[model samples]
Target: MSKQKTQPSMIGRMLRHLAGTHAVARRAFPSATLKAIQAGIGEGEKQHRAQVRMIVETSLSLGAVWRGESSRQRAHELFSRYRIWDTEENCGVLVYVNLADHKVEIVADRGVSRVVTRQQWQDVCRAMTAGYAHGAYHESTLQALEQLHVLLAGAMPRDSGDTAGANELSDKPLIL
Candidate 1:
């Protein structure tokens, strides 16, 4: 699992340890912003069969810290916990953001992976994190959702007969 900044300095780590708490995430991406993100997900899914989930976490748990958990590792755990890999078409994707580290991790299901390469996902993650570097959280997230929509629409267009496409997963962005 590759990280954005592989070797953060001791002081940077210490500051991030304090700055990236859950409380901070809530403040950064509050209930209203989260709702907007959920809406964006819903809008994006209308044109395709792909399932998209956005998850933002304020910081790592003490246990995770002791376990040496990285953002990429936590994204995998969240992927399973939220069942992002369990969609009907295996086209679910999770856009995970670790607020403290200002890191973004994009995990796609096997079906989506067939069309979208890991390098593409990494590019999107980097783009999203770049926005965060400028404190443009909402703009970055919305843009990422848009990117997912375009990619998924091209990869997995909606079935014509499926009028009332079901939402296999909640559109609500998980704030951890």
Candidate 2:
């Protein structure tokens, strides 16, 4: 018979950790901003799908595959830092939380470090530490995530909802 591995129980500890994370995320963002972020994510996805359709149309009109490929390359280069994906890669940090382990980690990319400054990170960390102590870290993390989403949404195209129809030609290829 094969032996089954059992997980350890830390229900009380997990609750305490979750409470702390919540507090920290909340402190990082405003309530209105959080709603906006959730809405933006939905809108952005719609826009991205339209942009893909635009590319398909543009490819056919431009003739040769090479031309289409070059255009795509140029488009990517032009908006590399102007979209959410680029923002995440270039100027964002990952906040990790482990309720079971009662641990929190924030990893920032080089771009984020360059733009946010050391003092800012320190301040955020200090606030998070306080939240952890008070069992509000979970909330704090949620707030921070909401704020980050809004910041990232700044990179989305202004008319992101306009989908590219089969017969329509994009004025500017919907760059970023």
Candidate 3:
């Protein structure tokens, strides 16, 4: 028989969330790195019709944690809150990193999701997770952006007159 893994205890999860503060996120992604990520997003958008947004959060609130909010749920919330779904082509992608949970989530809008399978999105998340595990925050983020650029370019190439669509969303990386 196959065995299933158990989740961490509630107390353990709470402790981890408490320990992961804004300082922890700042340490992982300094100001320079954040700027680099923003630049990457801008450059990547030039190659595709999709909009990409990244959010790196230190941890969820105690209330959220107590409510058993998973990283994917938090990512979806951020996606809606940030209006990533309001892109012109409806091809916005959100990359969410929850440090305390050690989880990476990719939430793509319907237009992109129709072309990119869930497994493909998970693959991107896995690659980023591997790099994060090794403490390569900047490198991992840029790499994931490159991967998304490739996917978006293939799925929805930017037309010659689509320059206006480039800045549909902000390229800034939100650090929460």
On lDDT, the leading prediction is 3
TM-score ranking, high to low: 3, 1, 2
Writing each residue's lDDT as its tens digit, candidate 3 over 21-116 gives: 889999999999999999999998998888899999999999999999999999999999999999878888999999999999999999998899
Query: TM-scores for all candidates?
Result: 0.88, 0.32, 0.92
Of candidate 1, the 10-residue stretch with the lowest lDDT total is 1-10
Tens-place lDDT per residue, model 2, 1-176, is 12222112233333433454444444533355345444433443343221211111111122222232333343343334324223423433433333323333444445544545555544544555466666654465444444443443344323445564222212221201
* Model 1 misplaced stretches (Cα beyond 4 Å): 1-11
lDDT of 3 at 60: 93
Question: Candidate 3: worst 10 consecutive residues by lDDT?
Answer: 1-10
For every model shown, the clashing-pair count is 0, 25, 0
Query: Given candidate 3, what's the lDDT at residue 79?
Result: 99
Note the Cα lDDT for every prediction shown. 0.83, 0.37, 0.90
Question: Candidate 3, clashing residue pairs?
Answer: none
- Where is model 3 more than 4 Å wrong at Cα? 1-8
Q: Write the per-residue lDDT of candidate 1 for residues 1-176, one digit (tens) a residue.
A: 23546445434655676677667887778777888899999988998998898888887865676567888999999999989999888988999988877789998899998988888788788778888888888888888778878878888888889766889988999887
Taking all chains together, the TM-score of candidate 1 against the true structure is 0.88
User: How accurate locally is residue 74 in candidate 2, as Cα lDDT from 0 to 100?
Assistant: 37
